[model samples]
Target chain A: MERLMKIDRRLLYLISVALVAVTIFMPLGLPVKVSPLAVQTYDAIQNLPDNSVVLIAPMYDPGAAGELNPMLKAMLYQCMERGYKIILGNTNWTLGVAIAHDMITPIAAEFNYVYGTDYIEFGSKPGGSVWMQSAQTDLAGAAIVDFNNDPIGQFPLIQAVPRLTQEYIAAVLVLDCGTPGAVEWLQIITQGTSIKLIVGEIQMSVPDSMTYVQSGQYNGMIAGSRGGAEYEQLVGRPGAALKSQDTMSVIALMVALFIVLGNIGYVTRKR
Target chain B: MMWLLAQEQAPVPTLGIFSAGSVIDFAIVLGLGVIIWVMVARARTGRKIPEIKKIAGLEAVDEAIGRATEMGRPVVFIPGILSVDNPQTLAAFGMVSHIARQCARYDTRFLALNCDPLPYAVIEEITRQAYLEEGRPDAFNPDDIRFLSAEQFAFTGAVIGIFERERPAANIMIGAFYAEAMMLAETGSFQGMIQIGGTAMTAQLPFFVAACDYSLIGEEIYAASAYLSKEPVMYGTVVAQDWLKIVLALIIVVGAVLATVSPDSTVLRDILGGY
Candidate 1:
């Protein structure tokens, strides 16, 4: 029992990895309980005014891609289904726009969405939140060119949405994992504006993002991967996230079991 | 629908007196300043101020250092992975100063590791100053105050390597941390180090609390310098912050009640959003 408290960390890591691998092959088929927050997030995006222009910012790097990719896909599917004109991009996360671009192109094609008129991708920009500040006034000036390096002023969507304001964009959907993310979006473009801010946050960041949700800074939030799965279900697109629920459940139970074992050992040893 | 026709970057709407969003922030800052000033005045006049609750993480600093000294092992301080511009990293300077002075007095090895070069440069001078103040400038080793890497994972790897090699008895980490918090804290735990962790980053706080023996949460790290130095003037400021927090809490409660009673009303939101 005392040895349980001193379980070598390498062994613990090995067991966790092995468990994850086993679940990948033979799924546990656990039911994922959808939280109220996920429902709120779905409704927030779903209930937007017909043909509303939405800006989606993938505010993360490759490191967070595994968790956030499904979220971005589900969001695009929902938007495209609603026939909303989409503006895809971000600032500071250089690699993020490319990832989002790949995900959006296929989804847009499936929806028969036309480029330049129906959607435009402004690849990543520099200057973090200051870029967002510039975007509020002049969209074309802030984003000089489209993701293809062509002049954005030619696009009808760009012409319709001259600035990032409530008058133009109805909502800003942000998939965030760190600084200069959804928080920056709220502070810069949305804050008191009628433009609603909705966020998809990583699991680690849900606690911090929930504050904004409660304060009505973020109109709604998808809490994490579980939230992503719930959102995918709501969007009627059961992608990779919904399929990976079994693995997550098994990993969660493994962690809990280890905690109980360690605590029992400590308690017994102390006595 | 207000058409934002002004194509160029429009200045924040100044309804003549002040900009729209600045109203609440301006009022809060002014009120906080006046209150803090009064508290400082009271302290100077030898009047009583409410004592801040003791923080276990900070109190254990000396014990951790003493343990390191007895074991003849190094005491490693990580000021987090962020630059000095972050307020949390600035807060870490105070702890580093105190810890460095203690290490100097006891002639124990002190190693300060940083992910960002700016904090690394700043912490070097801070450690040197601590040693100088303690009349042991000769004991300070500039080489130990190292800038490992700027990349997040790279820095985590380098720090983990240091732990394996140095075998530090005490590991004190305080500042703005991200995902790297867990890896660093867990490694320290594995080495049987007396660990003290702190950060204002709520996301990273759980990792620190889970892995570190002692953890300082949010505002506690901000109030650390005041707690360590025991200066009356600093105590006054901390108490004033508490007073202001109480006032804010009341406002939130009142706002919630008003919002619930009149769901359609934007009265509170408009006033707070503006003047």
Candidate 2:
């Protein structure tokens, strides 16, 4: 009982690593059920007026790539399928835009979306929330150049939406991880505007983001990896998030078992 | 009639200083400043003010350091992973000073680990000052104040490696933390070290609360410096911030109720939105 109570953490780590490896190689294909939130998120994007422009900000870096990357890809696919004019970018997190740019290239090509007309990548801007404030007032002045460093004034999509406002933008989908992210967008551009704010959060930030969703400040939210898988299912395109559901479930169950074992050992020993 | 009238008179937003919408934000900040000034005047005159409530996590700092001293093991302090500009990192400075002073008095090994280079420079000097103030300048080892890494995981990896090697008796983590909170807290727990963690980061709070012996949540971290030092002026500043929170909370509740009762009303929304 004492041994169980104080089980070597290294042994537990080894077991967890091995389990993760095994599950990845041979997935259980655990079914991912689409939740109401996922449905609402899908509807929020799908129900945007035909050919409306939307900006999707991937506000995270490589540390968060495992969870947020799939959310970004799924959202991009949905927007492209609906023939919405997509504006992709972020601020402060430079790598996020670069990572997202690579993901969108092949998908945009698949949808026959033109580079400057149908979609545009602003890459990663500087100044975090300050950049958001600038973009809200004057999109072209704030961005100045596209992902390729080409002059944005020459682009038709940039000319169509002069600023980030309800008059031009239909929705703002944010793959949020930390500060100067979804909250900044909500505070700066989207709140009290007709332009809907939808966010995709990493598991760590889901609790904090939920308040906005509950308060109706955020129109929709894709919760986490579980939410990501469910969203992928809704989009009818299964990706990394969908495939990783089995590993997540197994890990969760393993953790729960460990907790139970430790508690039982402690309780019995107390007697 | 109102809806039709609004559509016809769709107001063009003005680009100006002191716009009607921004007044509320400005007013609140100005109010906080006024409150702070008043409190400071009162504190200087030895006027009565509400006592800062005891924070158990902060109160445990001295005991945790003493345990390390008695056990002849190092005390590890990680002042989060952010630069000095962050409010949380600034809040951590006083607590680190108190810890370093206590360690200097007890002649215990003190390790001040940093993730950001800017804070590393600041914290190193702060630790040195603490030792100097304790009249133990010779005991202060410059090597103990190490800048681990600027990268998040790299810093975390380095801290864990240190924990394994040094086997510190106490771990004090305060300031802004992200994903590394759990990794560090759990490692400390397994080592059976007395752990105290504080951060305003909502996402990382649960990990600290669940794993650490003592956890400071949200504003408690902001109040730590004032409470630990019991400096009246600092207390006044923290109290002013608290008053502002209360005022903001009231506004939020009233706004929520107004919006709920009358869905069509944008009076409060427009003002608060700063549009």
Candidate 3:
């Protein structure tokens, strides 16, 4: 009985794993409130004129896919629904190209969006920010190959679309999951360009990103999963962001409860 | 309209409340359940876990305070410019609570530079609670915890000014940071203060690593709460997180193997692919 009374960590682990799996699969819905940032980002996209060129720079990989993918999906849906031309590219390695190809392509196809006219994947650029800045100068000259590594000129989409330097590119949204990221956009390229900057940062980067938003440097910004959920709400499509909130709430509750219980346990045992 | 917005399709019968219901939701709820179960089991067993290794960044709170005490300078604790709603900032709040207590212990003056209005008020309460917890409630200084501008670089500039006028012996930065990370860290480094920093920001982790003496990398920032409390519940969460990593590793290994061998297998493809 005493040994049974003794905590079996393995059992605890089992219970947690089981519970988490159950919650993830189950329908215990969490409440969602759209944040101001998400709304602004959504409104910006929703309000854009049809067939406007929207550039999406998928900056992070699978590690941050958990946050960026939902945001991208939501944004892509918004763009496709509104007929926004999306030019998707990345500076990261194959990880990013794979993410863009696997995640964004299918969704675009579902929306019945045509390649070249509606969207083009520039694949992975040669250099990070240098290529980004240079692309602003000469779109075709800079990107010689498509995401598939085919010649850019071969694709009518690349050949037909006017130079990115001329500012036909509507809004530039950098889904930044890392450093030398949004800052580069804010600091370097977008300084005098007509291109509006929308930064989608993970939760940890909010403090600094919020600063830019408050300062009015960024036209729109999305903060982590919560912001992503709120943006989905603003777009009138409750997707994974909204669904992830249940997880967030549960995790928050667990942490808060543990804090309280741990204190109680500490005092009691010491006494 | 609100009902329309919250409605769930296909899988679940429940009307969406916050739009937070999904498989991830189940995982989260389950993760919490496990933590609670472990804590209960630990409490029942009466097995006391050993103290975790002191986080140098946290331990330096007292050392920073002591330096401030000796130098007759105030200790500046920037609880990050983020609001209380942010988990990273919330962790910073937890650290603030401890720092405030240590400041009280050393009789050293402390100032909390904040950018977000909401978190500023919370930091004030955190300061008061820290004093109260240390049995020096009267020693709590409200003037020390001040709200800077909500703007990012503007907040960085505010901290810079505070450093100039007050000439703090130590600058401790914890929580969510972005571009201004370098601005603040560089300023403190220039002032030659014993700067300790930590953030879950993997990208900015490099900057902090290059600049600060002791920097908390990815998971360590989240582990701050557990490390500080040293409570069985918090410790249990760390254990759970470890277990999760192991599971994730296994999944990755299995996934890599299957994907490598079969390449075109439906099961492996489905695992890699998502809804």
Better of 1 and 3 by TM-score: 1
The DockQ ranking, best first, is 2, 1, 3
Task: Please report the TM-score between candidate 3 and the true structure.
Answer: 0.50
Segments in model 1 whose C-alpha atoms lie over 4 Å from true places: A8-11, A33-35, A151-154, B1-14, B40-53, B230-236, B252-275
- Residues A1-271, candidate 2: write the lDDT tens digits: 8667889888999999998999999888888889999999999999987777899999999988999999999999999999898999998888999899899999999999999889999889898878988998899999999999999989988888787877778889999988678998998888667789999999988888899998889999999999999999999999999999999999999999999999999899999
List clashing residue pairs in candidate 1.
none
Candidate 3 CAPRI category = incorrect
Query: TM-score, B chain, candidate 3?
Result: 0.83
Off by over 4 Å in 2: A1-3, A14-26, B1-16, B136-143, B241-275
Return the TM-score for candidate 1, rounded to 2 decimals: 0.89
Worst 10 residues of 2 chain B by lDDT: B1-10
lDDT of 2 by residue, B1-275 (tens): 11011112223454656533566667777888899988877777899876678877676898899899999999999999988878999888868888899999999999989999988899899999999999999999999999999878999999999999999999999999998999999999989999999999998999999899999998788788788866667788988877888977998898889878997888876766643
**The best candidate in terms of DockQ:** 2
Q: Indicate the residue-level lDDT of A87 in model 3.
A: 82
By TM-score, the best candidate is: 1
iRMS values in order, in angstroms?
A: 6.9, 9.1, 17.0
Which is the better candidate, 2 or 3, if ranked by TM-score?
2
Score candidate 1 by lDDT: 0.88
